[model samples]
Target: MREEENIIVGISIGDLNGIGSEVVLKMFEDPRMLEFCTPVIFASIKTMSFVKNHFKLETQLHSINALDQIAPNKLNVLNCWKENVSIQFGKEDLKIGEYAIKSLSEATAALKDKTIDVLVTAPINKHNIQSDTFKFPGHTDYLNQELEGNSLMFMVTDTLRVGLLTDHVPVKDVASHITEELITSKIETVYQSLIQDFKISKPKIAVLGINPHTGDNGVIGSEDDTVMRPALQKIKESGKLVFGPYAADSFFGSNNYKSFDAVIASYHDQGLIPFKTLSFGQGVNYTAGLNRVRTSPDHGTAYEIAGKGVADLGSFEEAVFTAITIFKNRTEYNTLTKNSLAVSKRKRFNPKN
Candidate 1:
């Protein structure tokens, strides 16, 4: 594992036409941020300089041709593309989307090769980012494929953590998607992530229902009784403290979510609506259950507020800090587990019974 002090955060500059650049520049403007981790932005130095000049930001930049020359305490910009790209604030441009993907792809490569410790991505335009080479709905979907493990869109903050059982799936297909296997796998991912990533020992996870009042004894819908309950029961039998299929309508309103370690919503909006409503600016979209650590601000490409110089730096800063914290937590967890395994092997091979 890399040392705690020298953690390198790989940043993907998302949607140059949106508020991504603004948040990224604003977050690193304060010299104090470098004390936490060295930020290597995966974008052209020229593009970043243009953005800096437009934003009138005083934060300095260090341009590097490769990751090996990354300097400590300086904002490094790795030139992913050298071509001059036009920037139009608040406009959906396919050319800009290509650059966003380029940044993300290189950052992900660095993360996979251990060149960077973690990744904190800025928001991207989901619609414009579709092309022949890249066709992911969002960052989570793309990273899920590139990374080692199953990805869970774990939206998190100090007080709350919400994971989705099925993300980026349409509402009409949501019920058909939430099978017993899907439920089990998603809950297991959440459970393991809590222990390994968040350092929660014995996590209690709650699942929101598919239908109102959990189908109200099959009156509203039969999915809760047939699918969700059985899956939760099987998980419970396996010794995990998993509960729910609670009414999605009143789950957060009643503050019942506070009783659990993390809540797994049935779908995207079911989870995100409450999460954003409660912790919008302060939340981080943490991609949990993957081998590499990655996080992003909960809000997406704010086209309306692009280049306005009024974007909130709260969420972006929170994403950076969250990425660092999770990286350290996972490192410590791996070390402890390895030591435990070694001890177990020694005990098993001992001559004395």
Candidate 2:
């Protein structure tokens, strides 16, 4: 795609004391990334400067004072703050968390206003970035509240896609949260996203059971038999190509996940443990079923490797590219459906008739 046709990607600077700035800089370092999309980082220029200098990296910076002045080839850093915030690197600071929130809030506003086509959020320390203002588990939860929609944390890679039925919830609390309604709704959302977001015409899905061996037909646990199996039957009756309350342990191990387009894991660790183990740096977390496009890296803010310049940009860059691809695919799908009835009629109408 040409530079002008490239989608506008708005990035939120996560905890500055973490690897957010480092990874963001590394993504744009290649210069070729600009040809695919126009990136505008919602961060203080000072933060970018500090990270750049500390790593001794070379890249041109274009401070975004005005939206219309965005340069296609330059790294656009919209100054969310005027003064330079202190870089603590490995330490968590209140000032850093507050600053991260500012960037997120502004970027979110821009997203809602259509200032950017898509958003690529950096990883934030959930505990530090929390307050009365930000009372959510993480980015996915925060955006779901902001956008007022049922959001599925869809983890993606080239070969596999996994969506969480319940994310960021503890193992003890997970059973209580897994209800018939929740499972049905999330599966429907995943189905729609498979068709609309991923452009799969007929997507097959696998639903992992809450318990081992899928309750072993009611011996291991009852939720799988009482809740998930019934819900899966109802979903299938509704004409969706969904199957399983399969045992989580054997689903991936038996290579059953490859037969379906997507897998719905019961909780966080159940899904992410295997996904990260297999895809790791190549994975992208996409928020499905929202009105706007949003994606993030599969990994979190690595405090250990914060300013060491060893932070890999694999997931972050993939997140940006994935956002752009989804945005473009959505636009194309919308355009295709605009006159679908007439198009169908014309294709079906024959000269003999």
Candidate 3:
């Protein structure tokens, strides 16, 4: 494991035209973020300058030629592209798409090389970036492919954490995708992440039902009875604390969600609708089961309020803080594990010798 002091966080400036730059700038303005980790923005200096001037922000920006030059109390800007991107505020353009993709690619490369400890991505426009060069549904799918496809999308807040069984899929097609293998895999990913990354021992997970009232014992839908129930039972047999197929409608209302550490929703809306209702302006989208830690604000590009300076950055703030916390926790967990193993080896070998 690498030393915690060397942890550099790579941040992708989402769409240059959107609030991505604004949030990134706003986060840097708070001096507290620097104390936790060094943040390296994978964006061109020109784009950041335009944002700062347009918003009249009082934050300092430093353009660096190499990753080794990154330091504390400085906003490290990695100039991945040399093109001068025009600032259109809320307008979407092909140029913004190109720039966003460029920043993400460079930051992803840095993460893969272990130069960056974690990644915090700003929201990107799905429609604008639909060209051949950039053909990803969203950041999660894009990062999944880039990192060899081992990842899960999990929404998190201080009080609640929820993982999706199937993300960005149509509601009608959601049931088709919910097989025994898929549910089991997602459950295991969420389980392992809670235990290993988040440092939760014996995390309790609540799995939501696909149909109403947990399919009512096959009266409404058998997918919950046949597919979800069986898989969850198998998981429980493994001694993991998992419960549910609970009615999505009543789960949040009854406050049953509070009993578990995390909830596994059947689809996007099944999980996000209630989560957003509860944590609308302060939710954090976390990508679990990845080789490198990644997080993003729950909100979108907010194109209408791009340059207004009225974009409430509560969610972005939470996302940034969550990334730092997770990074620190993981670093500490790895250190403790290493120390325990070393001590055990010494004790065993000393007695044998």
Cα lDDT tens digits for candidate 1, 1-353: 67999999999999999998888888889999999999999999899999999999998999999999999999999999888889999999999999999999999999999999999999999988999989899999999999999999999999999999999999999999999999999999999999998999999999999987899999988999999999999999999998888889989999999999999999999999999999968999999889999999998888888888989999999999999999998999999999999888988998474
Alpha-carbon TM-score of each model against the true structure: 0.98, 0.94, 0.94
| Most accurate candidate by lDDT | 1
Clashing pairs in 2: none
- For residues 191-269, write the lDDT of model 3, one tens digit per residue: 9889767889889999999998888888998999889989999999999999988899989999999999999999999
TM-score of 2: 0.94
Model 2 regions lying over 4 Å from their true place: 1-4, 341-353
**Deviation (Å) of 230 in candidate 3:** 0.7
lDDT of 2 by residue, 1-353 (tens): 22337678999989888898898898788899888888999986787887889988887678877667667767899987788788878887877888888989999998888878888999888888888878888999889988857999999987899999999998999989999899989998898888888899899999999998888777987998888888899999989889888889977888888999999999999999899988968999999989999999998889988888889999998898889888887787776787796677777886454
Off by over 4 Å in 1: 351-353
lDDT of 3: 0.87
